[model samples]
Target: MTRTTPARPVSVEAVFPELAAHRSRTTRLHPRPGRPGMRDSHVGGPMLWPADEPWPVCQEPHRPETEGYAPDEIRSARAAGTWPASRSWPGGGTPGEGGPVPFMGLAQFFRRDIPGLPAGPDRADLLQLFRCPLTHGSYLERRYILRWRRAAETEDADDFLATPPQLPLLRWEDELPEPCVLHPEQVVTYPWAEDDTLPAALIARIDAWEDAQASRHGREAPSYQSDLSIPPGWRVGGFPSWASTGPLTVDCVSCATPLRLLLTAGSEEMDADSHSWVPLEDRDPSPHANPTRLRFGRDRDLHVFTCPADPGHPPRWLLA
Candidate 1:
């Protein structure tokens, strides 16, 4: 036998006042798009507040006052030898004798840029921005200030055998280099070898094979082949012929899967996003270098999106 449960009584005070009053308040209080709540006030529209209402006052932080200098003042200072300039130390002197002397104070160099006059130079100006064409590595030039060996002429040569320290003078320039057409993300593999191991035996075999094939054919072997009999994604062009049989294997950083090798013949035009380049025909031997074999792997990161109806879906409420 099953037991029956009694129903609980409902209280009038527990009911919502809006529903109990029988007065239906329309959600559309304002005339606007969709379900009206608050309309966005765009510029050129009529003001919401009264015309006499005081305008919202913004309290912004006060900037420090700056003094204006005339062009003649700057020119006169430079003409009178008051302007500061970096000068090299004079030769033939004791250590730290003619090292670095303060040429001018900071106050003199920190001048405002005048319209007609030449712009005042800043002390911390950069000279250049050097970038590698291949790997895009940045390099800076450092000055090695060597001191004269005082004990070289004497009996003891190692007396003055101190390591000379280098001074790093950061060089930067206003002009920027052309933006890199191919980003590192677009390229599959870095051109440089991870290790210094050279394939000596492989190189010898490749040389011998190319010579025998060329001599037998009476001309250079076809650099490119369009046959579909080759492996998937393998194309013949600038890639070394021995590369197909080479034992080198590149694993993907994400999935650790071996990538399909594709040899692009020439510098191809890339997409707008700079993600990939369009494949072009086989490049000429004289102009084009051997194509680099790049490894491909899958990107393992998962992309998540929000469910529209269920706002509190999943472990947390995230829109993305």
Candidate 2:
């Protein structure tokens, strides 16, 4: 089904004309629970992986005693309405031991389906996302794996793995994402209210405007942050909301080039406070607000930023 965002109650540009300069477009990937295929743009679905190419895996060390289960097994357990106490741990060994731990297929996006989706190296048309079930590094971050492939090349491969080995031992059950189909919709968005790029005087004016609005309309009064600035959901290529942690400067470590937001996996399609962002078709109050059912750290949104100068550079992620 096609999802459409309702028109903004108030014209932000009309109220703050100078803020028009920061306006940009973002593609909302309205993910709904469904059966997604290998060739389709989807979340937690089969990917168009080359048959001969070896599947990617996580080599980082994980506690050998932790309970583990593969993605497919997890789905099966969910269907059966019973999560297993323990599952076969792949590449099992003692603590600090490392081996081939299969990575879960998180998401896949085709340039043809999503507008403003950043191009991969060599102008590739498909972007595949993967994540290790285990947390790694000092921050206990879930490692994200990216692959840029040509859809045409995988079409006539000698053979493909209809069912790839689900070997990764997921540490957290919440990390597993249920399969979801995408309904891509492009919409206008502006930077966060606390974005450092905006001039201080304009911010002061906006603060004054917000205060006056509160006085007039009380809690329901439209504010720049929640109602006008950013839409909350899984989206591609737009400004990131720093509501949780103020503004942050994200730059490429390989080079000094400023990075751009590539994708965001938010917990909610629209929160209670940001009802304006709810799609017209889904305006009716319902429990389907979180179809994907995936939650990030502390229920925060995961924002991935990529280097514009070189797509091959490692992308950075921020949980905010």
Candidate 3:
């Protein structure tokens, strides 16, 4: 089913014309549980991978594969509509003792399905993402691997890998995302209130306006931070919310070029208080809001940024 975002109650640009200068277009990936084929753009769905290519594996140190379910086991539990929340790993060992663990196929996006996608490296037309199911780095950030491919060329290969390798054990089962198809809808958005792009004077004015509105309504008013600016959910190419980390410079470590938002795997499509951003079709009571069931950094949204100047540069991820 197609997903459509309801119109904002008030046109933000009408209230604060300055926002128009910072307006950005983002494609909200309304992901819902389904069996998406390899050719489709989706989250946690089967990827169109060529047999010749080796599936990505995380060589990063992990706690020995002691006490976690295998990929097939997780899939079985999900299919049976039961979650083994308390399931323990089969073995016992310390962290950083495990060998290579296969990366999970996280997402796939076809150039034809998404608008405003950066040109793929080597003029490729498909973008695939894989993630280590465990945390990494000083921040305990989930590691990601990106692959670009020419869809036509890959699909025309003699044979395709039937299934990518899966992790032998998954200690962080909640990070596993349920396969879901994408219903991409482009929407206009603004930067977070704390973004440096906005002048201090303008921010003060906006704050005063909000206060006046709240006093008049005798309750908290519609907020620019939550209601007018940066939308929640899995999306592409929009501004990131600085509400958490207060906007750190996401520059390319190799070329020093400013990076752009490539994708977001948010925990929720819409929160209970974000009813305005809810799609009209999803207003009826349902659990579609968190269909992907992807959890990251204490349920914080994961944002991936890629260097626009050079697609080959390693992508960076932040949890906000």
Candidate 4:
């Protein structure tokens, strides 16, 4: 289903004209419960893999979690209808039948599909992501195996692997992305003291605008730079919607260069009972028609980072 962005009380641009320069681009991948095609741009969507190529695998052994079951046990429990909680993991379990599919998509990004990204080798824009499902710690953070392929290489783009390989997964499934249809929106981002180190004068001006908004609205709204009001799901731009460790900035290990925000894979699309940004027409508000069914760890947001100087450099993952 197409996503509906939240509505704002008033345009920030109307308040402070100078802040308009600070805007950035962000697209929310609104992935509802639907069948995405092999060639579609989506999370958990079918991959454009070659007919003869081997499906990727992760070899890490699964250890039992104190409260959760192992990879195999989880699958079995799901099949028998004994699993706890209303839903488990993203995309709400394999296809229509709620059993373990054995693998999860960690992260996904496209060089050509996205508007502004540094070029890579072969002059062929690539579509990259990861495959992993096993957990490593008490939080059950799943690891990942990175995969990158030229978007131009697959011409026919037919034939898809029926089920994901249940083999061992790698050590870092950084960000979990669901199959989603992107609703690209271009809007300016608010400058904050944390990520953007603005001069004292600019910072004061931002504070003043926020104060005015709070006074006008009769309550404290989210700060200008904090959680810049974007729709839920996997988004590419605006500030990240932080839950756990708040905001963090990491530098690339290979070159020590500061990384740019690549993607924010969120669990749920909108906050519970939050009518803000829920679309003007959505009277039902609880869940969309065909829900995406994907969620992050404990309602956390998984952020993927990459170096702008070299896209091939090892990217970093941060939980916010």
Candidate 5:
């Protein structure tokens, strides 16, 4: 519940109140390597599900029905806080080894912790996102969604048996996410892409402000718009630094309301030169690598966008 500090630290509405309407907010799930338990905001952390609830499965099909199985070597390695020495990957295989595989916990959010979340699936308190491990047709991975009551609501949360399915994995072989505590910092952000742009009048005003700052003295004055915080590493709110593709916009198909950035999935703990994103007080002195071996996609990022006006609206994912 700490106050959000922007990277460059500027107030958006303060300079131009007109631009307020176009302003958007995001929560960076700053994931890292740690031993986060079931009741924590973390990526790849332990799930707080009902012990008796049947684990999820993927019935989705794949290219060919070629099937073979690798034992629990990788799982054992992950449990031991390390990666397997070797893996048996599918050059081309069926949807699964045989039966349905369980989904792995990707992200968890507490309703009480985040203030702006719309009414979502798990009408209770906890929002858990599970990704099926099987690779479907043409690398299509299936996802299992669970919106459930908070772990605190259940008395036997710690005693529950959470199962992660054994399915085929590719690049994420070494990318086993460790449980890390979330240090939520709420920062203001602007749409960096033309598709997610402010109104023309607002853009003009921002241009004028940039011009004024340009005329101001000293090298510290903002020259480029990016001089501010396009934070690297794992963060919640703020503009995303696009790589493969630029900033994208996915409107709520049902309501047509512009979706907002809900998550930024990255492999590393910190991107180079994003020293500002690091919290003032952090456990690790060397912020370069996360002790957790999780990578979003090798070194790429996965951006998940959700509806701003309606939480019931389906979300969209963009790999940038």
Candidate 6:
């Protein structure tokens, strides 16, 4: 006699109890579009991760060894005719002695969140349930974060205007935020609400974009992964004058340690190139007199300076 196996349950409730729980949680919270969630702020602010939650398992970390080229080696090789001189470095430079070199790789490798997903499951779920304030679409979007120097605050300015007007704000779509091209080690998410004053319509759009990403993810088959690289035509910009004329100081975003500035564009090869961030030997308070000054505003932002103390190492994402 043959033995028979018991039949498994086929009901919707049986196959995915967790999905049901997710739905219930989202329904209970009923977050309005643009409202602050537990993981991220409705207004711009730092990202918060819950201590008790399990981190998502599907994240891909950045692999620098696999994707990056050594600056010194690349430069030497180029000088020897091994690599093309026109090749651009990510974050855009060779590491100098005094100042920290700007990171020159992909941005995705530095962040850990899933592209297009909120920082945590709670925010992701909340965003999924949110309806577009304007179109009522269920899609979500992603945005990018940009950094810039801060200017002094003024009493007359609005509370939101405390930072410099030229400071680059990190912005992204709620649906599919771009991954750091180099670091793939981390994912960039909404660190804060935009201006601490997001409109409901905008929030809805974010939610819709996120939903769209999820749908696309589900429908697509997994594909082979490749190393990230800078787009051919793109180049990193924005260096400060202090970087070229040394004794420069820069603080790390992660550790707050001070870095020293060393070397600006040195040598004839660096000087001849219009788009290179060559290291300098020392501060030249009179950098304005240098011919490179003409390149500023005309070709790119002034080169900023930094040092390589602990925690002051440039982020890898900036390289690409």
Best by lDDT: 2
Q: What is the lDDT of residue 104 in candidate 1?
A: 10
Question: Where does candidate 3 clash, by residue pair?
Answer: 62-96, 63-95, 66-91, 67-89, 68-89
- C-alpha lDDT of candidate 3 relative to the true structure: 0.80
Residue-level lDDT of model 6, residues 1-320, one tens digit each, is: 11111121122223323223322100001011132222331212112222332222111121111123343444355346464233343453322222211211111100122222222111122111111111111332111122211121111233331121110111111111111111111111111112222355543554464456457775331111100100111111212122223323346665666532211121111222221112232123222123111122223222223324431244211111
Q: Which stretches of candidate 1 lie over 4 Å from their true place?
A: 1-176, 183-200, 222-278, 281-320
Candidates in order: C-alpha RMSD to true structure: 32.1, 2.6, 2.2, 6.9, 5.2, 25.6
Give the Cα error of residue 81 in candidate 6, in Å.
28
Score every model by TM-score: 0.17, 0.90, 0.92, 0.71, 0.70, 0.16
- Which ranges of candidate 4 are over 4 A from the true structure? 1-7, 65-103, 106-121, 156-160, 167-180, 191-201, 204-212, 219-231, 272-274, 280-283
Q: Any residue pairs clashing in model 1, and if so which? A: 126-172, 127-171, 127-172, 127-173, 128-171, 128-172, 128-173
Quote model 5's TM-score: 0.70
Q: What's the ranking of the predictions by TM-score, best on top?
A: 3, 2, 4, 5, 1, 6
TM-score between model 6 and native:
0.16
- The CA lDDT at 88 in model 1 is 32
Could you tell me which residue pairs clash in candidate 5?
26-237, 27-236, 28-235, 28-236, 28-237, 122-147, 267-295
Q: Candidate 2 local accuracy as lDDT?
A: 0.81
Residue 18 of model 1: what lDDT? Answer: 21
**Compared to the true structure, candidate 4 yields what TM-score?**
0.71
Assess the local accuracy of residue 162 in candidate 4 as a C-alpha lDDT between 0 and 100.
Answer: 57
Name the better of 1 and 3 by lDDT.
3
Off by over 4 Å in 3: 70-73, 76-81, 91-95, 137-139, 218-220
lDDT of 4 by residue, 197-308 (tens): 4456766776887787678775446545433434455667555654466456679899989887777767666664234556544567665522444455676666777777
lDDT of 3 by residue, 6-49 (tens): 88867889999988898999999898999999889999888998
